[model samples]
Target chain A: DAGVTQSPTHLIKTRGQQVTLRCSPKSGHDTVSWYQQALGQGPQFIFQYYEEEERQRGNFPDRFSGHQFPNYSSELNVNALLLGDSALYLCASSSPFESGYTFGSGTRLTVV
Target chain B: GESVGLHLPTLSVQEGDNSIINCAYSNSASDYFIWYKQESGKGPQFIIDIRSNMDKRQGQRVTVLLNKTVKHLSLQIAATQPGDSAVYFCAENPSYAGGTSYGKLTFGQGTILTVHP
Candidate 1:
């Protein structure tokens, strides 16, 4: 009955460094997707993972990558972070049968 | 180049008043549309959704109306309250794109709604 859960609600990172954010999807869900939201803007789709393989991706650069474990959990990794990388990273999970997706509280990444 | 967009950047209304947020989408092939509300420091929450076949769908206190002719969609909140204040976004899915991108959503810039008590 647990909703999507993300780790390290907030974090601070310096430029050129890499960071990894984790997410535990809602029970009975198998699909995981990541999104990035900048200040005063809506979230932009990053990529989606289904069955441990990346199925769909947005217009993000190659520096942004993600992985889905067998248990349906996911991790988003951003390499060579820039100040512009500072934003709220949200994780959402959905099932193939459902029309709506559920989102986690999100991890706030601050690039210094 | 197809994208979703909102008509208003911000909206402020007094409590107990009805509120309407509008959005326009360029992808006519998008058959599924959804509305999401995001609070400060939180992820977007699903509010309601409508498909191309249907013109309207109603939720608890929210309603979504889809006009495929003009490629416009609307979310109406009845008796807006302070808790209703948040940034609203409209998302679309191009189902005809193929199976691999079936659930992929393209989101709008969002409309900020402020309900003053």
Candidate 2:
């Protein structure tokens, strides 16, 4: 079975521009969660989606939004990107039986 | 803000030496714990996990120990190797928070591990 896969392995965007990242969950998984990892820092929870609906969100502002498709694919969108938005965006997929999450390679976003 | 923090920023050890990384979490309600390893420029990968009910869980060369009494969590690597060099993070999940609570992971500041030959 394939693990979580993310698209646009690397992205370069300027400040105030918007970007969308995509992720495909592993086989048989139904939950998708997003995280932001800054340099030398651990990942911070952005939000989680289940059943194609956002079930929870982190401390991030309204600028960060996400969508989960019925097939368990997910997309993370950032509006008016800031320099601070530059980081490794990780997509983790998991199921209730398996609390341990499997993370994708991640999309590296660099906001200049 | 509630957070999971590490006592050390970096640690170095020779190959074949055992390594231990520590983490402290402020949220006592957190019932689930996990440890992840992230190489430079890579997403965090699951290493091992221990539930609140268990005090210790061992996997392959990695072992995770959770101390609910002190709200402390630790990852122990036996016979550490060069491949073990990476940033280690501890995460906690507070079940009481409710809603999409299963996958949510609050990570620690992270400890960078460097293994020398």
Candidate 3:
């Protein structure tokens, strides 16, 4: 089965600009979660979506948002990007709590 | 918030040797745990997982051990190969009421493993 897939393997944006990343969850999975991984750091949770609604979110500000479609694909949107926002954005898919989540290769955002 | 952490920042071992990476988690309420390995420029790959009720689980050459008494978890790689070089992270899933906690993984700061020839 195809694993989680993300679009725009790499991207660059200027400060205060906005960017959107996309992800397709693994086949047969319904839940999608987004994470931000800085260099040499573990990924930090951004938000999670299930049943087409956001169920949980992390400490990120309102600038970061996400959406999940009926097909289980997800999109992450960040407005007014800062240089600190430049990091690897990962998308993970899973079924339910206590189940393992599968990660995507991630989209590397470079805010200049 | 839950805190999952590694005991070492980096570990280097010769090929053919066994490698043991240790982790500590602050959430005793966490019911599930996982180990993931991520190569440079790549996303984390699932290795093995152990539930809070179990002490150990084995997968091929990798093993995960959990000690709830001490809030410790470990991953052991047998006959470590050069391809094993990567960052390893331990993640936790804390329990919650109802269906609120839907398999959200809280990852620890990973440990870098360097297997040399």
**Best by lDDT, which number?**
3
Residue-level lDDT for A31 in candidate 3: 88
Interface RMSD values for all candidates: 2.6, 2.8, 3.0
Clashing pairs for model 2 are none
Predictions in order: lDDT:
0.91, 0.90, 0.91
DockQ list for all candidates = 0.55, 0.57, 0.56
Query: Tens-digit lDDT track for model 3 on A17-109?
Result: 999999999888898999999998999999999999998898999999999999989999999999999999999988644357889999999
Per-residue lDDT tens digits for candidate 1, residues B2-108, read 79999999999999999999999999999888899998878899999887889999999999999999999999999999999999999998862322325578899
lDDT of 2 at B25: 94
What's the lDDT for residue B52 in model 2? Answer: 86
Q: In model 2, state the lDDT of residue B59.
A: 96
Tens-digit per-residue lDDT, A1-105, candidate 1: 889999989999999999999999989889999999898887888999989999889989999999999999999999999999999999999886666778999
Which docking category, incorrect, acceptable, medium or high, applies to candidate 3? Answer: medium
Between prediction 1 and prediction 2, which has the larger DockQ? 2
Q: Candidate 1, which segments miss by more than 4 Å at Cα?
A: B96-101
- Under CAPRI classification, how is model 2 graded? medium
* Model 2 Cα lDDT, one tens digit per residue, B43-72: 788999887889999999999999999999
| Predicted candidate 2 versus true structure: per-residue lDDT over A1-112, tens digit per residue | 8899999999999999999999999898899999998877888999999999998899999999999998989999999999999999999998865557889989999999
